[model samples]
Target: MGILNKFLEKTKICVIAEKYSVAVEYAKALGCSKKDTYFEGDKYVILWTNGHICTLYQPEDYDEKFKIWKVEDLPIIPNGFWIKVRPGKGQILNSIKKIIERQEITAVCIATDSAREGNLIGEYTLMAIENKKNVYRAMINALNEKEIKAGFKNMKEDKYYKNMTLAAQARDEIDWLLGTNLSRAYSVIYGKKYYVGRCKTVLLNLLCKREEEINNFKQSLSYGVITKFKNDNCEYAGRLNYALKSESEARSIVKDICNKQGKIDSIDRDIKSIEPESLYNLNDLIRAVNRRYGYAADEVYDIAQKLYEEHKLISYARTDSRYIKKSMINDVKLIVNCINIDKFSMKKSDINNIERFIKRCVNDEKVIEHTAIIPLEVESLEEKYKLLSTKEKNVYDVIVENFLNNFLENYEYESIAFLTKVENYTFITRQNKVITHGWKERKKQDKNIVEVKEGEYVNVEDSVVEKKLSKPKERYTDDTLFEVLENPAKFVEDTKLKKILRESGIGTNATRALLLKDLIINGYVTRQQKYIIPTIPGIELVKDIRTDKLLEPFFTAVIEQQLQQIQDGELDKDELIKDTIKFLERHIEELKSIVIPDKNNDPIGKCPICKRGNIVRAKDKGYGCTNLKSTGCRFFISKEILGTYIDEKQVKNLIEEKQTDVLRFKGSKGEFSARIIWNGNKTQFKKF
Candidate 1:
C-alpha cells in the first residue's frame, strides 16, 4: 500500500521538444511561465533538444583498421549500426536522462517536428538514454497554442511511430555505408577527395550531362519574313509559317508579298480561363522563390525555416503536401482573418471572400504528414513587420498572395487567332485580350488586342526578312534544376523506369536543396549567376565512375520505394539492410575491377616552392604541387584572384617568367587591373 501510494502520487509529465523555439511554444501552450534551459511546472516539465541529440557512428568508430582508405577494404558494412550522443550535446543528453529516470516523472511526450526526421530525433534521444518508460507522441503541424493543446489531448502511443523511426534509421545507415565506402574507394583510386551520395551523385551527373549538351550545341542561322498588316486602324504583325534556310529564299518570299493585299481567311475567338495554381509544397516554394528573386534553393529553404521557427508566421516548411486537411478549415479562416492586407489597400469584399476561397485548398487525401505552408493566426503585421528582414518580408508576401489568390476568380481572357492569305502564303497572328483581371492582378499578364473580321481585306504596310540563329537549351538554373530533381521522367527514356522515377524523385522535398548545395560544396558543381555548371573535375568524375547501377536515377528511385515500403511496414528493416549489403558488395567488386583513368596528372607548370614537383590544376580552380603527400610541400596557387579566373596561359607565363601581364578583375568596389607574380613561396597580385 505504501509503494502504490508513492507511485500514484507522481503526476509529473515530461515533454521533450526537438528545438528550443519549439520548447518555448510548448511551454507557453502548457501554461508554464517560469523558464530556464528547461521549464518546470507543477504537473509538467518541458525540455528541448537541438536538432539531433545523437547520430550514427562514423567509420573510425567501427574499427581502427577502417581508418585507412584502401581498395582491399572496399565495402565497410556494419553488422549492427550503433548510435552515440552527438558531440557538444552530452550535457543535454545527461539532463534528459536524469529527468527520465526521476521517480517523480510519470510519462514522456515527444513534441518533436511531425516527420520522419523528427521521429528519429526523439527516438535517438530516448535510445541514448536507454529509457523504457511510458512514452507518447504529439503530432501537430504548427506550434500554435491551440494546435499544441489539441495535440496533447490527442496524443498517440509511441508504438504507432516505431515504423517511422525504423525508416529513418534505415536511411541513415544506408547513406553512411554508401557514402563512406564509395567516397574512400574513389578518393584512393583517383588520388583526389571525392564525396559521394545516392542523391548527390545523381545531381552531379545531371549537371555534367547538361554542361556537355551546352558545350556540344551548334548554332544555325535561319531567316523568316515578318509582314505587317493594317486593318480598321489597327496594325498587327504576322510571321510566315515556314522558315527559310537562306537569305535569298526569305527575300524572294518577302518580294512576293510586298505589293499584295492580305485577305482574312478566318478569325477565331475563344474565351480561355486559367485556374489558380495549387498551394506550395517545399519544392514548389523553392522553385518559385528562385525564379522570382534569383535566390538559391538552400537560401529559400533557410528563409522558410526561419519564418516557421523564429517568426511563427508560417506552418511546417519542410512538408511535401500542398493541401490542407478538411479539419483545418476553421484554422485557415482564422489565419485569413488575422492577416493585415491594408498595406496593399485591398477592399472589404476581397477580405470577406477569403473564407470561401480557402475551402478549395482543403482535401483530406492530399495531406501526408503535414499540410501546405500557410500563415499562422497572428494579429496585424504592424508590430511584427519591423522585425522581419527584407527577404523574410518577400517570402511572407508570396505565401499571402498565394492564399489570397484562392478567394479570387479565375483569370479570363479571349484568345484570337487570325489567318491571313497573301499571294500563295498564309500567315497566322495570335493575340490575347483580358476579359477579367481576377487573380492576375497580383501578376499581370500582357493584354494584346487585334481588331479584324473574317473575309476582310488588309493592306500590307511593310515586309522584311529577319535573320535568326537557333539557340541551345539554357543552362540549369536553381529553379529548373529543382524542377528536374522533382520530376525526372523527361530525362529517362524507358517507359516503366520513367514512371518509377517520376513517382520517387532523386531526393525528397526536404533534402533536394541540401543535395544541390552539397554538390557545390564538394567541388562537383559551380554556380555561375543563376546557372549551375559542372567543373572540369566534376565532369570527369561522373564520366569515370558511372556504371549500370551506380549514379543512376532508377537506382535511387528503387531505394526510395523500398524506404517507403519500410515506412508502411510492408518490408522489414533487417531484410532491407541485408539486401543493401549484398548490393554494395557486388558494386564494390565491380568498382575494384575497373581501372580508374588518371585525369588529374596533367602538369600546369613547375611548382615555385617545391622546385622539383610540378603544379597541376586542382579542384575549385586552384593549383597544387604533385609532391603534396611527400616532403609535406603545401605549394599552391588559386586560379581565381579577386573574383576573376586567371587565364591558363597567363598562369603558365607567371610560372615561367615570375610575372604575367596586367589583368582586369572585378572587385567589391569596382574593376581594377593587377599583375599576377610568383614570389618564390606563393603567388601575389600587384595593382598597376
Candidate 2:
C-alpha cells in the first residue's frame, strides 16, 4: 500500500525550462507550490537548467592525443560523436533524473527555449533516465500566464520534436568535425592557434575580402554634362545619357548644349507601390537595432530574451521565420490593442486601418517553429518603456515598428522618365511624385515631388560639367553582416550554391552573433566602432590556408540547409555524416598540400582513413600505420595475402591512391586479379 501511494504521487507532469526565471513563470501559471529547487503542485512539477546542462564532447574528450595540436593530424573525423553532462552541471542533471524517476511522475514535458539548441539540451538531459517514460513538449513562445496555460493544454508527444533534435545534433557534429580538425591543421601550419570554425571561417574570409577591396580600390574621376531646362510647370536639371572620362570632353558637350533649344522627346509616367517589409525574425530585429542604435547582435538577443522570458513583453527570440501563423490572428489583435500607439507615432485611426495589413503578416505556410518576434499585450507596457535602458528601448522600438509597419498603408509614387534632345545628344530627366505618403509619412516629413509633361519644348538656362568619384565598398557592420549571413547569394557566385544558400542562410541566426564574437576573441577580427575589421593575422590566415571548399560560404550554408533537411526527415543524418566525411577527406588533402609538416618519418605518407597515421614497412612484414600501436588504427597490408605479393610501390599506391593496381591472387575458389584497397577499414580487394 505504501509503495502504491508513492507511485500515485507520480501522476504529476514535469516541466523543464531553459532557465530558472522561465521555470518560475511556468510554475506560477500552473499554480505549483515552491520546493527547494523545483516547484510542485498536485498535478505538476517544474525544473530548470541554466541554459544547457549537457553539451557535445570536445575533440580531446574523444582521445588524449587530440589534446595536443599536430599538423600531421590534418583531419580528425570521429566514427561517432558523444554528448556528456557539462562540467559542474552533473548535480542538476542528477536532480532532474531523480525527479523524472519518481513513481507518480507519469510524463515529462520539455519547456526549454523553443529552438534547435534548446531541443538538444532537453533530449540530451533525458538520456540520463534509466527507464522509458512518457514524454511531451511544452512549446511556450512567451512566458505569460495565458501562453503558459495554452502551452500545457496543447502539449504534444516528444516525438513531435524529433526533427528539431536531429537538426541540432547534425549541426553540432558538423561543427565538431570541421572546427576540431581544421583548427588543429591551421594552428599547426600557421604557428598560432588559428581556431577555425564552420561558419566563422566564411565570416573571416568575408572581412578579408572586404579589406582587399578597400586596399586595392583606385579612385578615378568621371564627368557628366548637366543642363537646366524650363517648361511651363517648373525648371529641372537633366544629365546627358552618357558618362565622359575627361573633363574636357564633358565641357565640350556642355558648351555645345548651352543656351540651346530643347524639346522633351518623350515622358513615361507610371504609378508604383512598395509593400511594407515582413515582420521581425530575430536576425531582422538584430539588423534593425544595429542600424538605428548601434547595438551588437548578441546584446540585442540578450535584451530580446529578457523581454520574452522575464518581462513577458515579446514573443520568442531567435526565430528565423518571419510570418505569424494564421491561427494566431487573435493574439495579433490582442497585442496591437495593448501597445501604446501614441509613442510609436501611430494614431488610433491607424490601429483601425490595421485590418488589411494584418492579412499580409498572417501565413500558416510560412510559420515553422515559432512566429516572428512580436510585442505582447501586457499591462503597463507604456510604463515599462520608460524604465527600460536606452539600448533596450531602442531594440524594443524596432521590434514594435516591425509589426506596426504592416498596419500602415503601402507607399505609392508616380515616376516620370523624361528624355530631352539637344542637338544630337539626349538628356534624361527622372522625377518621382508622391501619390500616397502612406507608411512613408511616418518616417519622413517631406516628399520630393516633381511633375513633368512629354512633348513640352524648353530652353536650356545653363549647362556645366559635374565630376564624380566612385567610393570603395563599405565595411560590414553588425547590421550588414547579419544581412549577408541571411542572404549570402548576393556575394556568392554559383547559381546552384547561391540558390541553396538563399533558402538556407549562411549560418543559424541564433548563433551567428556568438560565432562573430569568437572571431574577435581568437584574434581573427576586431570591432572598430561599427566595422568588423580583419586583423593582419586574420588577413594572413585566410591567405595562407588553401581549404577552398571549406572556406566557401556556400559550403557552410548548404550544410546548414542539410541540417534542416535532416530535421524534416527529407535527408538521413547518417548519410549526411558519411557525405561530410568524404568532404572532410578532400579538405584535409587541401590542407596537406600547403606543407602540413610531417611529424614522423613513415615515408609512405599519411593514412587515408586515420589521417594522422603514417604507413611504413616492417622490413618484409608488409606495411602498416605507425599509429596502429598508439591509436589502434586498422591499416596493414601483408606482403603475401592470398598468394599475392604486395611491393613498396604498391604500399605507396595504397596510401596515396587508396588502392593498388589489380594483381593476380589465389583465392579459395580460383585464381583472380583484383585491386588491393582500403575498403574504409582493414585491407580488402576489389575486382574490376
Q: Candidate 2, after superposition: displacement of residue 332 in Å? A: 1.7
Task: Give per-model CA RMSD.
Answer: 6.8, 16.5
Which stretches of candidate 2 lie above 4 Å from their native place?
Answer: 1-10, 72-74, 77-79, 129-131, 231-233, 345-347, 353-355, 442-448, 491-494, 596-688
How do all models score by TM-score? 0.86, 0.81
Q: Write the per-residue lDDT of candidate 1 for residues 1-688, one digit (tens) a residue.
A: 2212333544777889988888888888888765656887766788989889999988778888878888898798776888898889999999898888888887788889888888889989998898888888988788778888888778777898888889988898888888888888877877778887878888888887765554345557899989999867678899887888999999998888887899989888999998777788899888888888988999999999989888888988999988998787777778766776565446224555555565668888888689998888986665796689989888887777777777778889898888999989989898888887777664454655778778889989899899997765677998899888888888779998898888888899999989888878877788877878776567657866746455678888878888888888999988888887888888788778877554357787888787899887665557778898887789766766654445456768888999877665546675455677888866777874
**Candidate 2 lDDT tens digits, 484-568:** 8888888767899889989987777788888888888887788766777777567667876686665678888778888988888
Error of 1 at 667 (Å): 16
lDDT of candidate 2 vs native? 0.78
Clashes of each: 0, 4
Q: What is the C-alpha lDDT of each candidate?
A: 0.80, 0.78
